[model samples]
Target: MPAGELFTVPPVRGGTKPEGSSRNKQKEYQLVRVKNTWCRVECRQEMPTTWEEDQVIVSQAKIGEQVTESGVSWVVKAPIYFCYKVIETQNLLNPSNKTLLYGHVSDPEEIDEYQKKTQKRFVVMDATVEQIYGSKVRKYFEAHNVVYKILALETTEETKSMDIVLHILEEVHKFSLDRRTEPIIAIGGGVCLDAVGLAASLYRRRTPYIRVPTTLLSYVDASVGAKNGVNFCNCKNKLGSYTPPIATFLDRSFIQTIPRRHISNGLGEILKMALMKHKGLFQILEKHGKYLLDSKFQSTNVLDCNDDAALKTTRLAIQTMLEELAPNLWEDDLDRLVDYGHVISPELEMNLLPALMHGEAVNIDMAFMTYVSHEIGLITLEERNRIVQCMQNLELPVFHRDCSFQLIKKALAERFKHSGGKLRLSLSTGLGTAEIFNNVSEETMMCAFAAWQEDLGEHST
Candidate 1:
């Protein structure tokens, strides 16, 4: 059936009833176009519903819907509303800062009421993070007189599985959380945040959750979005959901404890947004990336929140990410520029799990795709060189020995299969600009691969 508008059924009609409805109260609907468009369901307290289709003039609703002469089917088309903050605050360990408690209150109006209640939270923290800040976190919570359970897990790519999610759920079930107001807090890297999000989404069918990223990678990449999952069947984030958190609290000071390589790993993601849509960001990383890395994103005062390359880099990354994520939160539109480095990275990252960091794998994918873009005449040699040099300057790996042509072909094949039969690969047409190209030929790919290997794979073979 062709897609059209979905109209509400008038009150219990005393008209001719459709066959097979069984009873007067029972409504029937022939399901069509629902997969392609959002269809409104007529819901009443006790009345039945019937559905069919008709081509009519459009409505002000952005998502169109339709119905016709079929059994009544009721569906609540109410949109789920939840806003999360990606805040930048200092001394997350200090009870005086109240950074840990901010996730509990979504709005300022709730602050006074929240302070009056006995607060409690279930926190899922990365083992590494817990090792460094566990005592401090406990002290902060104790000082606030907040009842909290902090569960530490080794949430690494190697351990990103359903088992980990189940383990978290087991703890959450024991905690007897109040699903509505009390949130499951995630404190760690992307893996920790992803696992905790999945667990929170599963528990009680969508309990509220918060993300407090302690690594630069998670701070800039994972904490800004709603996508969460664990690896399954050897695929990265194979089992996942678009369940966003109630808030995502970011603190750059957390990066101080992480290794320098991990800092570089996060920059790989920052560089991604830069290459895709922000030229000034790319230039900043190109010039002052070393400063940001050495200072652990605290080149200026962490509390200042202004006047530094590190500050600009984090904000730019978050803004660019949100600009892409907010409208397409559910990924209703599969063609996304934010997927620039993700096409091959998932397979490549999983194929070499624990060896290559998520951002490293992504940078490698981006690096090769850069050559593909160059071969397709989307960018100049100078532009391609600048991107590669930028990656190298940020201490990111541009190529991998394990990332072979066969692997590339296989990854692309999987991507093509999953992406609605089209590659829909996002490639940089120029610095800070990119486009989704579904028509890049295998010939172009092979030529690009050969050039990419020659330029960066010198130590591979």
Candidate 2:
């Protein structure tokens, strides 16, 4: 048989028809396109035969219609909507009873009860993490009899591509995951979370998944956001979706396993949030900045819920992040406080990837913008210097060679389009407060960049 052409169909004549007659109709009509008043349809048979009322017509005025040139009228189904929540927790690797688990380490004795109400689980972990805690994770699962498949991969800035995401998708399909009950678990830093989250969003056309961030950056920033994507064509998060995980489990315990630079990298985002929205958080970072960078909460790590300072710092950072994100989960509003230092960070980060971590780039961005604030009198010289000094104390980079005035101008151009034709540049008016701007001259930006470079040289020497 030859291929058929695509043609519109008209609704059946007479708005209503007998149900029994349509159902028993000998001839069939395949609908092409349906509209409010008419439906485009085609007849496969050579000639019209007996029409069964019930077969074609679903209701009195809908679906099947009476024979006539005028089409019938019907109602289309209602639209669909989705909603979910993100949570914070400790030691998510521990088994649990409730579908949604949050907060603190689980007691060994409580495991028995917690596991009883659990569902099957699978994990997609960063390969590096598996090397560090593979045995521990396996032991925990075995102790609880929680059957799970682990798919570990190298999730690096360079490896954050669609090809990597597709590989994860293949692994997810192999598990034949149950979309609703069985959740896919992702464990690692931001890159790992991004790849895994993107994979979960695709599987079964959006399977529920969980996020277990293993780094300071992921804990405070990445895991909490609904944006999930992999890079493409050298653009950060070019191929992505705004799909929030079913839940996000924050375990400070995981940060203990990584080096201090990663912790400092995370402090970058914490600092960004502090400056943008939380004055208290900004003050906390300033006062306890050094303590946080070097304090050992546990014998094994930087995070100890027992350490009052560390707990306060971690809680404030997470809380501030949620405050900025909760209202703009989909970024429908581009004039966001959370975009504080993000205007130029994406390009700067990618340009310095493997050498400069994401948060490090953001710190550099914030530092430059703080200089911009000072130039415009939005912030005082002392305040601007204080922010830079705090970043320096935390071991975060305040300046990067790649973050030049020209680069910033170019980045702002791209940002204007991304932000819906508005500059929407977030600039700090003072500590813990920021305002968006649609215009800032290149001369002012260049001066700020120059001042940052000079400060960097002074600090270095």
Candidate 3:
């Protein structure tokens, strides 16, 4: 029999046909005449079979079997490609889907240009004090004729309330939507980005937004991915959403006016990325350690001191880390990648009454985590010492003594609850490999804390 010929008898819809001498499964076989030749063939069960006497039977292999010369054999696994074609049989079918824009911007001037190109409503959330960048941002928007709203966030610890930030975002979003805008835009550091990004997620039930990260921390770590949110009940970043921005713009010009402390803070985040994931970054930092340390202050002379080389190295390192970890950002497998040093740092920041900067706390937390890793035999003592030495070379504190042991224990216990009873922290196994654990004993934590306290005491006294 040949293919595509009419048959005298119509194929049964749900009835069985015989296969040689055995009873065939119902709807498993079809009999047809091809070019006036009659033959029985297996139905393509993977596809919907239509009944027609004029239609010819196509040879399709049976389930769990492959077609062969002698007989059907068990099927071996092979990749299959599926192409779908939607049939517009219904009158109400719609084909147009919503457009989502994702990316980042780094300059204040480029915000208007991006808005014009992407047709997204723009908003700039500034984490710095209003007296510094607020007027400048407003003037930039005005000169470019870009419609935007500037939310000048307060920098005090009391103003860092997650609820307050959320309220501000909600009000801004409502204002934007009262005029029928499509998307939201955020421009600032990690705190501003997280707060605004959360607002964008909640407003209109997940409106798209773009990020223009001005600070180095956001540029290297926070602003690149979709994780956005704010601290809850004094716990750092406790309430939030994993909402990826539509786009990100990396502009180095923003770093020009950044304060020295801000620069060092951002460096702390970069160091965390290097220590936890990329050994090449560690090498780069080691090579240019002095240059980075000297480039802390904002001066034309300081900027010319081979600082561009260090910035380029850090940028490349962060780009590589993002490319390697992009797929896992929204998934559940965040065990090692969560090694941003925020696990313990967040607790300290809350308990120490908020004078400690986020990255400073992270700096101390990374040191403690490294110490714990060494004690647990995950990493050698030398490696742990090297980690502390690197941080010290950068002029970052490896330990802090602002809180007492009782205060530390209380903070960790609270953190344990806030993290959903799982105290799994990202601990280093070596320079690049990090492990997450929920089973770190309280005794181990206290011992490590005590050691760190003693070390600090020796240095201070």
Task: Give the winner by TM-score.
Answer: 1
What's the C-alpha lDDT at position 214 in model 1?
88
Candidate 3, residue 25: how far the Cα is off, in Å: 19
TM-score of candidate 3 against the unseen true structure: 0.67
Error of 1 at 156 (Å): 0.9
lDDT of 2 by residue, 1-461 (tens): 12211121333555433433543222234443222223324344332235333344322121233332334323232223345555545555654523333222135555454546644567888999999877767766676566667888999989999888899888778877567557788889999999888888887778877788889889888988888998888888899888888778766778888888988999999898889888888888888877777862222433554456677777787888777777788788877888887889989987777788889888888888999899888999888988989898889988877677778988899998877887887899998888888788888888877777887844555
Instruction: Give me the runs in candidate 1 sitting further than 4 Å from their true place.
Output: 1-76, 107-109, 303-306, 459-461
Number of the candidate with higher lDDT, 1 or 3 = 1
Q: Arrange candidates, best TM-score first.
A: 1, 2, 3
The lDDT of each candidate is 0.84, 0.74, 0.61
True lDDT of residue 140, candidate 1: 89
Alpha carbon deviation, residue 159, candidate 2 (Å): 0.6
Model 1 agreement with the true structure over 27-118: per-residue lDDT tens digits: 32332333255443323232223433353222223332223354545433335665777777777788888767865575787877777898
Clashes per candidate (backbone, < 3 Å): 19, 19, 12
